[model samples]
Target: MKTKISTLLLLPFFALLMLTSCQQEVVDITPPADSEALSASSPLTALMSSASKMDGSKDNIIDNASCLSIELPVTVVVNGLEIIIDSEEDYKVIEAIFNEFEEDDDYLEIIFPITIITAEHDDIVINNADELKEFVDECKGENENDDDIECIDFKYPISFSVYDVNFQVIDVITVENDRQLYKFLKRVKNSEFLASLNFPVTMVLADGTEVVVNNNEELENTINEAKDACDEDDDNDYGDDDFTKERLDEYLQICPWVVHEFKRNNQDNTVEYQSYALNFKEDGVVRMRARNGDILTGTWSTRVTKRGALLKLEFDTLADFTLEWIVYDIEYGKIKLYEEGGNRIIMKKNCDVVIDITKERIENYLQECLWRVARLQVDDVHNEKDYIGTPLKFFANNVVKIRLNGEFVTGEYEIGVRNSGFFLQIFLQDRPNLKLEWLITFLEPGLIKLENENNRMVLRRHCADGDDDINYIDDVLLTWEWEVALYQDGDVNKTEEFFMYTIDFLENGWIKVTDPNNGIIDGNWLAYRHEGLHLGLHFGIEAPFDDLNHRWKIAEITQSRIELKDLNANGEIERILVLEKKE
Candidate 1:
């Protein structure tokens, strides 16, 4: 008996939320124009309400309802086989069972006493089939137009300022997800208070493109234009199993798909195949780029069957990917393919991935600028700390050098080609992490990703040669003798600890601190631009100064004074440090 298991919550309605209790934090508000506010009758409000509506079509296989979703963990009997569905992945199990026997009539029976969430996110308990059927009867026929706008979604935590009847700001509410947004909007729709969305709110289209709208007009126009941009997939099918062969083929060929997860015959091969890209061409041809910069050719085809959309790939050397895979789930920028016996492959579309990688191109990109060792993990041990303040420079003569503490350490580097792919080998004494024959897994204009058996390294290009900001920061630090003027550690006034300490920012990536008693403490410091301008300090357990060691955001900088602050994940200031030039 072939039956499919509904694995997990495929849509928002099935997912529950644990709403966080927020405290009222008063902030400065700049009220927008009347037209910029979100009112009950605004078209943008309607679009948002529609977009926030519960999409119940995802679990149609179990409930057969397009406006309601059965909350898990629901028990069901598929062809007399009792199965408990706890998550969305179980959907594949049920579908796999159904595809097992093509000739048998697949039937499913739901276990009673389950909860169903309605289109308005209301929960209703059903004890038996009669009660469930009555609610199901109220739902429109499959694929009919519904109140929910499935083609777009709001990227939370979007915030809105709630005002009193006079438009005086009262409260600011932050919504974490769709449910919370919908509930908040319901209050706004009822004219509870005048509310305006915070500017620069992000709206996600059906195809995963994010549009940031600054005001009400832009928000309204964006929602109206994207409401019907893509297929809503508001049918009874659990996945995109109803997609035609032509549609499936076209989707795969739109961009190169990079292997995110792979399992072959019950064995996890994700790391081995991760970042291996496959580009499906028009003429049944597919090109796979291996991690080592090697490209392999293969043949691909797709077909629609009673089971679902099927994608077949044939590659002589790539045996793991040579199978007829069932296209179980296809989402924005991603596709999930699986087969019986624990074989599955999850690929994500990457339009930026270059299929044709060459040695000259790699060398040219590396030589354009200095590369920072942004990330380094060898045998699960993070070693990037040792490479701090160090940047690698590549030259045309296969020569590479790392600037360590203001000194250049020369090394020989080579871009080697092999059957597996491209490999980068660097011969530098005392730097064992960079000595590995790393396979170049990913490469772009400003970034290079490399890995080996148990090591991974990510290098970000840093072209500081003509950067005005870097020059200004470097000149400011080197030209002045500074002292800790203010150090606020969570409201504590600890500035007096370093009353007479003089600081010198040396060009050799060293910070020399002289005490009032003529004692000196040496430390490492680097000023760089990432996300913003930052000053990285490392004192290595030196008293008082060690406490100031952190990658502090350069909040304010000038010839006389420099202010740096440590920010929390929410972009809130946690600590403040001020450095004033000594006369």
Candidate 2:
């Protein structure tokens, strides 16, 4: 079976549309202007009024309340023996008939006592009271003893009632048999009719067989043929087997037989069986092998309680037997078989079987494992500067080595200004060396090496302050000292004395004089001074010399001093006197 979960996703949309449509139609009705102006009655209204009056009346009036008595037809069949319905009447009428039959010799003797089963009212719809009354009158007859008979056997269950066109409640009739009557009375109470007359019908004889006729014409023809056959069988027994077989043959010739097909199977032997297609005569009773072979013939019995068909099987010869059969379209074509208190087998159409995962894909998935390794190295060097400045060396694609020494350090250099000068130093495995120093005044762009080694080097651009014509020298030069004396006595005492000194440079037209007794002085002081000289003196007690230029100025003066002349032009002096001090 196919099953699915269904959802009404659009139900609200349809409901809203229905609500809108219902709101558009409007109906209005106005009542008559006054109730007094309305007419009291009309012809159709009178007829309805009469119908209501008749509905309140009853037929059998016993005391103040009206009583109702009804007779019904009944038939009974027991084991294929049909008990036909002959006459119907109320309780009183049937009692009278039985009493009359007991006294009359023309009536047949009562072989079986009339058995009372049940009495009940039939369900009916009556439109008016007249129709109910008519139904009672026709079934009861006039004065309860009329010769008109209305009840007859029709071979099936039936009931009758009377009603008007409006389908209102009228009287009702009930026809039942012994089985139906027993079931009916067991469900009800206080039954009235004790018994009713029912006739036993005989089969009509044609040739030697029994036949059935439904109408009068056919019944009469069957009776005449039975009379003729009776005369020919004066010496034969009517219930003998030969007579029965002959009757069966004649019946088969006259009546057509219907055929139906039933298929079966034997599960153990794997065989199939089937019956000829036959018409449904009555409830078909049959037993067939599961392998499509007829095994037995009997009445097909049905279990009303279980709601399933039953089959009986018996083996004619002694052999181990197994039976398997399939009934189609029962409980939606699902066949379940049970044996020994458990389900033995089950068969169904359109089932699913499943298997999982393939092998090649699993093998391919297992082959995908990998391994890898990683290595690391680190170095410690004394010449970090050289190592950083040196060009990167590669011994091989994956290996590298760096070598450095004091003399030829395989390292790098740095070119930049330092404390003493603009310098370049090399980083090496040993101590690093300064490659070059350009004095502040002598900075230039060139290549330099550290410690006279070409292994560690640098190229740099240097700068300084001066005219471009300047040159620098590395000279170990000595400084000069000077002393001075000033005399306040004409005797030239050394007690009052002071000394001063200065230096000079001869290159690049620059000079610097450094002195402790005097402040720093720049420029060529030798060219500016006329009479003063840089001097050194010895302190002693002696007469001050009047020849000042001859004693000190001769050795201290590095350049010649210019002489001054007298402007008056006189050639000789009278007294040759000089300042000489007695000490």
Candidate 3:
């Protein structure tokens, strides 16, 4: 019954292609020897090397390709699976459209294959003309239903010809600058008129000499001449690899290093993500082990930038280390990285722990951050609403502080084993006999679950500073639950059944009263300062609940208790009512 809901914090993948404008130089096909993965003679390599301002992202290619113009008898990799593309009409139509490349025509009128994903997470692959028609028909109908696109992963390294605004062939784009070519393709997807090209796309030789090709024939000749240079590109980074999990396990002689230092904005924060480690296998798989033994799997690769800087780690997806980090140095058991946002992290050997696994992990996790009780469960029934405003904290000295109800209760705790299982024993100063033994059920950086046989409590790491920043009036009221502890009209005592009814203030000048006898009653309530020393509430409701409908003056207010006096227009007290915030 103990469940933890985690909200993913994803670092967005983004990049900008920087362009440099200059006059054409003499052909220098002397293999720039720029990137480790790309050959020197590749035209893409030469053009990319010419960029004066290079960013971390455009330094490589990351894209979702849906459109492609595959050459007949060419091999295409779709989701890491390679297949041969024969002479097909749709491919031919796209090829013909490029053949008649006219810049002023406003658009290329491209009809390439779109990656169709069904609602059940299956791909719709069309092999022939009939299948293509069927797929399109199904797609048109799918618009009305939930069956839609999972993603549009474009067929990368698609042999496509680049044309300028004049409809004249500019260059043949291939896998050499696959990263830049991918960006251009993404831009073309949302584009209605691509008359103005975005990529500083000029075909060139290895020596930065611009290649001028007026027609598709010339561009083809140019690319063919650079074939040997282009062949050296590593398609592994292109996500077209045959490496499986078993293969990677057999391949890695050692795991990636652990993060020993984390600095944001140039400040050292080695203690933030305590006990962080990463395992980047040779097969491009990345695994992260961080606070409280939570393991996250992602993809990482190393590529040489055109500027000839240090080889940087390129990550696909992660919560913390989100962008391309420059590897300052990486050795057998140590690695240093610099993120684009001026944040840096260092890693060393990740060794095994000697303490009790659950205890040590949970203690370290708690010390690194503040937590709040999001839910409490007893016998599988959730009682989260009762402790709505409480926040918790754990220090390194085996001490814990819980802001319960309206008081801060400091407690002592111990991490030990009992009956072949792990237990967290919390001894509150006020309640010594009532031992709160919580079984260590679940633990993560931002979430944790502790359960006994019948009780479970789910705590969440605070995303921002605790709601303590909220001022007392409306903001504080919205954060906490106020309940009627006692109600009276100077003669009758209604405090006995106070648990059966509750009053909650609403933002829209309304009040919702939960009644055990009835169901729910909607009324109006307002609280404001009448005089410098007097706080007033205008409470109004219908029939049986009519006694609470009176202009009341607040005599005192505290974290747990509130005192109000029923008063007439003359400001004379008739009766007193008391309320307390639920713990």
Candidate 4:
């Protein structure tokens, strides 16, 4: 008796949907006994409905967002049984699909195996006889590196009957014995469909002679010789590699290797190598491709040293290239070159291991590009681009830097893990009680989206023509009295005795105004937010000085000038104050 195994994914509208959006409702519907056209409107409505629940305030961007993201696990229903993908075989299939998506294609069609039942209902035609061994082998976990390391065999072989454009039965093949099973698995590469076991069952290979053999590895070894004969020339570039001299030779062969990442002298010099290439020939010659198309040739060789293997390159054009480094075990995805005194880089291979999406990763993702307010609705009012340039930046050591008006303001951030995954918890140093929590719903290349309990934010990587050189602002603000370019209403003139007080903004949200007059007035200051950021102070501070007590909105902060405004309920300005740095 042959078991029918087949399934068709009918997610018609959710093209890029994944596990993160599992809340996407699937309309209740049984598999059609005959056939019925399904509509996409139901699922789309559910998705839109789910989005409406978030707070519509985009201006409330605080540390309350998460960088957590999850991928969809393999799931498909077969022969009335739901199968959750838990083994490497399933992961391989999913990985194959992802790789295929990068290539140009109109649609994806997968080969399926099944048993065809006749209209008479009494008879079943089975066509998986030739495909059974491969399925059983895969279920036993072949070439598996991680979780699915155990061997498991199903009680019986499963297959699906092929269907044509008109849904007409095309073919069915079944395996009655071991010899046919061997032939099926041997020619698996040529076959369009690789077998995926439908129902979950566990056993050793021996169901007596019908079963190929007993014990998992023995069965795999018995058929591998035949499988290897067909796969000699077709293997993944890195799959067959072991960390040996031969592997290193293969890695450095003919192609121009671009230094994708770099570090030197306690500083990241990756920008120096972006447009250059380092080509190491087998004959000991290394050719360097300069940014201006100048060919700066160098000699390179690998030698055994007391530290380990050493990668030595000598280039006359660039003295920095003439250095030696001990080869640490190459990992973190790319070929890692490490030297003494904290210098190393992960080369061309796109292999950067991120365990928990660390602060550094977020900094790299955000700092590389400036992000503008894509959608900002605060108190049911949309916030236009009142600010300019890349306004926000995430830095290491749990810090967040933001540019308001022309000055740089910074705060703190943290990530927490719960039952599902990770979440973001953010609050400014000054406003500790105003904490924000957000579930990190999605992240991808060039885009990061955050949805809070009350707000939804979408920040596109800004591609404007400006360099990220906010360091100069830091230099000017290092120590300055808030004076010089003073503005009251529309007055862009100087203020008196602003120099008597040495102005200071502490990272912990403390603003100390100390002068001989009333001794000192300590106030809580908050910055780096979208909505009203306040400085709490109501003491001997006077008129123009009383302006500091209002709920202030940052207009611009730069190295030389600072602009602030008193905000009313509807975002109308009540007053404006400008101050220049006292050098």
Better-scoring candidate (TM-score), 2 or 4: 4
C-alpha lDDT values of all predictions = 0.81, 0.24, 0.46, 0.41
Number of the predicted model whose lDDT against the real structure is largest: 1
| Candidate 1 Cα lDDT to native | 0.81
Q: TM-score of every model?
A: 0.58, 0.14, 0.31, 0.24
Q: Give the C-alpha lDDT of model 2.
A: 0.24
Q: Can you write out model 4's per-residue Cα lDDT over 328-364, one digit (the tens) per residue?
A: 5443344556776657655553222121344345556
Worst 10 residues of 1 by lDDT: 13-22
Residue-level lDDT of model 3, residues 395-456, one tens digit each, is: 87888876543346788778777663566776766643224677665455666667676686
Model 1, 308: alpha-carbon shift in Å? 2.3
Off by over 4 Å in 2: 1-5, 9-267, 272-284, 287-300, 304-311, 314-338, 341-583
Which residue runs of candidate 1 sit more than 4 Å off their true CA positions? Answer: 1-63, 67-129, 138-141, 144-230, 237-242, 376-382, 405-412, 418-420, 427-436, 451-456, 463-500, 506-512, 515-524, 527-535, 538-583
Cα lDDT tens digits for candidate 1, 94-114: 766775543468888999999
Better of 3 and 4 by TM-score: 3
Better of 3 and 4 by lDDT: 3
**Best candidate according to TM-score:** 1
User: Where in model 4 is the C-alpha error above 4 Å?
Assistant: 1-242, 303-310, 326-333, 349-583
**Distance from true location, Cα of 427 in model 3, Å:** 3.0
- Candidate 2 has its poorest 10 consecutive residues by lDDT at 369-378
